[model samples]
Target: MPLSSPVPRALRHTRAIEVEAFARDDGLWDLDARITDVKVRDVTLASGVRTGGTYLHNLHLRITINRELTIVDAEAASDAVPYPGYCDTIAPAYKKLIGLSLMKGFRLGVKERLSGVLGCTHLSELAQILPTAAIQAYANDVIQTRDGAGHDPLPDKPFQIDKCHALRAEGPAVAVYYPRWVAKAVPG
Candidate 1:
């Protein structure tokens, strides 16, 4: 199971931290209040661990962060669950949201959307989609990169937010593997 943070429960300050952090980058914001709930999915091929084309096994990272990070009103965001059939079906359609060259743009768009809402002082809370901007931006970038770059592999630069609300921005922080092929054999 993924582990929740040591930050205890949500409070005004904690919520603020959560809001500010998530309000910047959707991926770093684990709105679910518990990191443990965040799962990274992988794609595998031919029963091999290291060989084959891979998709980020965890397609639900965006969804989970969106669902969990909406702390302004837990009740309102409670219903934001992963699509029932998403995992089973996403593989065929899965594509990287951010490629190597455009990661800065991809992340910047996320921050723009998140921060954009904060300008609304009258609104004490931010919406789920506000954080989703990152995901959407990445998706858009991925489509363009794939089409324009001719199948060049892009590096995944995953990031995370901490209790202090500081962002740990660095190289591909999270590694998710997707197997291009799978075996019918079930483990006994």
Candidate 2:
């Protein structure tokens, strides 16, 4: 359902985030995330004055992970920033993400390694989307979500079964779409 119309309001600032996932030929996956911030009105910053429609911040973050969802390579770039030299210098710090697992404690690990002055706020925020993005990219290709009829030998439950409201183990949606897993999900 779409949201109800709201009171008329003027546009001021806009922030756009885009994430793309790619399956590499070497049997790995790459998730690239970018963030852009633009102001509809002129803004003054310590670096200089940013004209309307110009980018105040443009950042990119990419992480390459193996089938196990463990990050093997990570990189970040700051193309446009409010504070040029200082803000761009922190891009290299994102390499700390290597070796972290997207399915396990990834958010907390990001905070511990890149919070506060350790990393740029925009780029760090972009990293948070990678986990879910990777999961969506690997839905059927890498991880068998069992969305279709199959008697595959994988024994573990579907990764998304209890992850959200609609896919809750005991929810009606599950009863109709994933009936086989329903019995195993209910309390004994």
Candidate 3:
């Protein structure tokens, strides 16, 4: 979305991040995330002044996991980058996420495993997409579990109002899985 202003303007910088989730035929999941940073107008960066439309960052990441949401494989690549040498070398560190689960505290685990010299900050950010993507990839199972066709989806933890307000203990969404927590409240 472009910001609106009374002042005249020209395209400057555009940073786009896209994350996609895929359900594999064998009951696994695949996540692909790409980040593209473009200079829409001449701008000076640490490297040098870049021409408009030049890509400052073209990074790609892929993660594969099982139904349990435990990472099975992970890979990252930098096709275009603002810096050299260091950024391209972090590919090896992403493997450390292979057994990590797509669950609460997953982001902190990713940061701990890949922060500083071990990982590129951007790639580390991409690791956070796994938990949400797992929801998309397993929507059927989630709904079935909530409907009592499978195990309880919420586990022992009560509905959280802070994490996702729609699923709050005070909202109607609780009726779907934790009917005991349902009450009157704005869904959003």
TM-score computed on alpha carbons, candidate 2: 0.93
lDDT of 3: 0.75
Measured by TM-score, how close is model 3 to the native structure? 0.75
Per-residue CA lDDT of candidate 2, range 1-188, in tens? 99999899999999999999999999998899999999999999978899999999899999999999999999999999998878989988999999999999999999999999999888888998889899999998998887535556347778889989999987888777777777555465
| lDDT (Cα, tens digit) per residue for candidate 1, span 60-179 | 222223323222222112211133343233221112222211223433433443344322211112332334443443343322223112344444322222111232221121111211
Candidate 3 C-alpha lDDT tens digits along 20-115 = 888779877788888889987777768778778988888998998887778899888998787767567778788888888887578888988998
Q: Estimate each model's TM-score.
A: 0.18, 0.93, 0.75
- Candidate 2: stretches off by over 4 Å: 147-154, 184-188
Query: Which residue pairs show backbone clashes in model 3?
Result: none
Model 2, global lDDT:
0.90
Give candidate 3 misplaced runs (Cα > 4 Å): 1-10, 141-163, 173-188
Ranked by TM-score from best down, the candidates are 2, 3, 1
- Candidate 3 steric clashes: 0
Model 3: residue 73 alpha-carbon error in angstroms? 0.7
